[model samples]
Target: MSTPFPSDETAKETPASVSKPIKSAENASLVDSSVALGFPEGGFTAWGTVLGACLIQFCGFGYTSAYGVFQDFYTQTYLTNSTPSAIAWIGSVNAFLVLSVGVVSGRMVDRGAFYPLMKIGCLLQCLFLFILSLAKPDGYYQIFLSQGVGFGIAIGLTNIPSIAIVSHHFQRCRAVAMGIVVAGSSLGAILHPVILNNLINRRLGFANGVRASATLNSGLLFIANLLMRTRIPPQLNAVSYTRILKNSSRDGAYICACVAMTAFEFGYFFEVFYLQLDSTLHGLSEGFSFYSLTILSFGSFIGRLTAGVVSAYVGIPNTVVGSLLISSAVIFAMIGLQSAVSVAVIAASYGLFSGNFIALMGPLVSYLTPENSHIGARMGIMFAISSVGSLLGAPICGAFLTSHYIWWKAAVFAGSVATGGCIALVFMQVILKMRQKASSVCSKEAGV
Candidate 1:
């Protein structure tokens, strides 16, 4: 609760009463372009940053979105000895590291270490995927090292900072810009499967196909390195990372929001991870199963924009609730989709809704924090915490499978978990609104 403006003049004149100077050396660079700093909102530099970030997202999240195909392949061919649940951990580990290591990368971004992180991320992402191409059919450990650990670290370093830099360029359209930037993943989702299917199923075999994808990635990372630039330097020592965590954790609303985010992430990738498996089980052709991911990605691309634009009218948290609620229903309905067409429809709908939900994840972290300066660190901490869910969700879902591959148990688990996340979000929303109302009343009384 807000402490009312002190009862007496002297109490009101305490350290907290002192207004922070706007143009101080520390935060002078942190000011917005539109309101004060005069940076162009939609100029070439700004749009370049967006495009650059899009490439990074496409490379990182979008490329990995195809892990389902790989998971199925490893189970069916390469690592036949390993259980589907074990194979699922490789992808889960990737998702885990991508988010969990944000603590390091996020700190670096706050301290103007963007280029260093990007260079490492770009190199590691390319190098490890190539290394992955060398692993043997039973090389479960090798796959985990290269793809799950190395690639996850690479994306962790690269992804959040990529989108954060875009915020440096656009102010009013920042949300929309972020939505478009994230939509890059969906675009990648659409393109990578076509590229992979051509290579894996049609032209080259698994080994050669991976090498080809790695080669393509080197070029994309080059562009990303070129175009992504930070608009202004952060104020050194602006806030201690520890202080931000302690302060934020003390807030009931922020804690509730984190719980909500964790729940959503827990079930987020289950759909992507199992989409192909389910399609193949339903008697769809191999090509059709692969193409289902493309359909989902296409829908996600549209969903990202839809959520961003709609949130502009309603609200971000509210949009998350509504969209997640719809997506959760689609996820449940997907359990009954015996035909390719039914699978496509559910995949598309889920993509649209889940895309918006994904786009808002970073923005919502920034929203929940008390200080804008702490966004990167707070986001890092938040993702690290939530990555626990992403890390375990798949394994848990996989364990529910039976010997017969009647995977309805996994489907039910995914949907139910997502619905639980939505419930947490609702609680968070109520708490946040109530706190804002309380603070406003306290401000009014002080003024009187």
Candidate 2:
């Protein structure tokens, strides 16, 4: 029964081969190389990584959070006759660009391309904002092209890289870290309206107010660049382009998540802009509208934090589905209410769901993807689809409002979309459960 292979006793007695030493050296070299490339064995401190993630989020998402301010001003001052749907496209384009570019940029981050992209994104974002500052009231097209397209690209490039970096730096505490980071968007949402309102109500006028906000945002973006300068470790093997296009079970979840998110975006953007419009129409003080939005943002901040902690225990998918259901119910309730207090409740409720959905997305995407390699691209695709919803939601809702339909009718529209999203999430959960069961069965059969 002797074979050409050495016996166990003989192998034990044999001198270790030269390859053993070479392999040991290679492993040591890899560890050293990883360290040199900033791949800390234990990763970055959770607090520091979260802070960096928050800064990036502030710069990238603040613009999104600030859309209400812009939409209000644009409608009232520059484009009074413009349809809500039409005005939505500007913000939609911005949102789309922010998301669409993420696909490529995310892959770049997974490939160790974060730093350069971050630098370029920061510069371009600042430049675009500066250009946006110079936009004339009449220059709607330029504003759409510059602020929407340019800013979108910059945010997309910056956002995904920072998010991926956080994922690289943390695992167990990731949901909490992501929550803290995503809360920056709510912070921006809280501040942007107040800043815009103060600026507009002051002698400075809307243009000056926008310029001031843009200047401050530019500085914040620079700070984000400085704070978010971590490098990612390269993958051992590069993923082929074809693989990027292939749909997996995870991709189904991603698509469902994206679709749900899109519906949320549609409803959210419509409500924010329309709330302001309704407030103005009802002759409420600008302060009231601003304060209402602040309250919503505050609720969102709390919601994100709560969802993050809850997701750790209840799981992201379950939390997301629950949040969507709550959001849907709130939207349905909002339809029957007319008072300012009721509207504020609706806003706050919407914020809670919005924050939960957004904060969960990164972690969910991580769970669904084969590798973290295409996090950016997948995020981009998700957002791009969501942007389509945003682009259309406002205008469609506006059309409903302008056509002599009751304001509550618009709520119905939004509620219906959100309900559809909730249904999608349910299906996504079923698919996930089935897959998990199948995996368990396979493992049992394999005796491991």
Candidate 3:
């Protein structure tokens, strides 16, 4: 006689009882684990995560993009006799710090040390901005040291950790999430200048305008810090820096990519400075340069959003390549057009190109590296190294401009750099493909 539940011996022989209980138990266990993990039953919280990431990116990267406005104001009002290169250092250092500090900060976040670092960084950034606000006319060095260097350090600490947390919170819709987050920087770039322009025109002057902007940024950062808590479990192990560097292998292509990025930074910064300077030279009123920058920022905002959607489909490397090529063409075109239409075109093109590059860099580093663990260090190295270009590009261009007003030459220089950047990206793609093929071959061989 058979029992209500078949005996193991009988089940093995009967096949009816053999599979059902085991399958039921397995399904029950899976449901239990899913409940424990707290992951949504299906799909991901894409919208919420993307919104959070966007807010953080807007605050962290927005100020960085808006540096062009400060660069223009400083050069024209306070540092008139200072070399463009000299002034460029302030922005370069800020950018460098933002990029370089990621190595330590990224590891810290991985190690569960995000809160203290972020708090300190936020406070320091706010203090520096306040210090910059108090700067006297011709206090170029003070502003540079305070806003550029100080703010750079602050951003470096905040950026990677904030981004890392976003990665932990979402899985399926990461690209869209990242794109939305990064677009905040473009938004900031667009909005900040309008505010600054209003204040400057209202007779607040550059110092007062900057101070007000700084206060607003500081308040926003303070709120951001409050909201920047981690939503994921910390990594159990520290990421090995040596391994990260080893994998990044200072190959010819990698070096070339760095060079191209540097050149891009230089050209980008030069154009930013030149736009305002040109407005002045063409006899536009003080407020006009800010308006032009606002236009450029608006273009950048649209560009970043477009790049996100495009990169998602065409591939990040391809998107980067396409953007660089288009940017080069735009720079050359800007040389001849003097009409408002031409200026708007140039501004929009610059914004689009710059935004695409910025959005692409995060994915590009991932594409280049072997593991995601070292993303922070690799990014830091990239930023630190590329900053040399930022340091020199403007100065060299500025030196040429000092003797005579050859704005077209600067545009040519920009175009050439962008073209080279496109070439470097092509090589990077080739290397990545080869590496993937090698990886696949090794796996197959091991299986055999």
Global lDDT of model 2: 0.66
lDDT of 3 by residue, 148-209 (tens): 78878887787666666555444444455455566666777677667766765465886687
Error of 1 at 321 (Å): 1.6
- Tell me how candidate 1 scores on lDDT: 0.75
Considering summed lDDT, which 10 consecutive residues are worst modelled in model 3?
Answer: 1-10
Give the lowest summed-lDDT range of ten residues in model 1: 1-10
Q: TM per model?
A: 0.86, 0.80, 0.80
Candidate 2 TM-score versus the reference: 0.80
Winning candidate number (lDDT): 1
Q: List model 1 lDDT by residue over 32-139, tens digit each.
A: 222224345688878988898889988998888878778767777888888778888999999888776766675566566778899999999999989999999899
Q: Please provide the root mean square deviation of candidate 1 (C-alpha atoms, Å).
A: 7.1
Please give the ranking of all candidate structures by TM-score, highest first, separated by commas. Answer: 1, 2, 3
User: Which whole-number lDDT from 0 to 100 does residue 302 have in model 2?
Assistant: 73
| Full-model lDDT, candidate 3 | 0.64
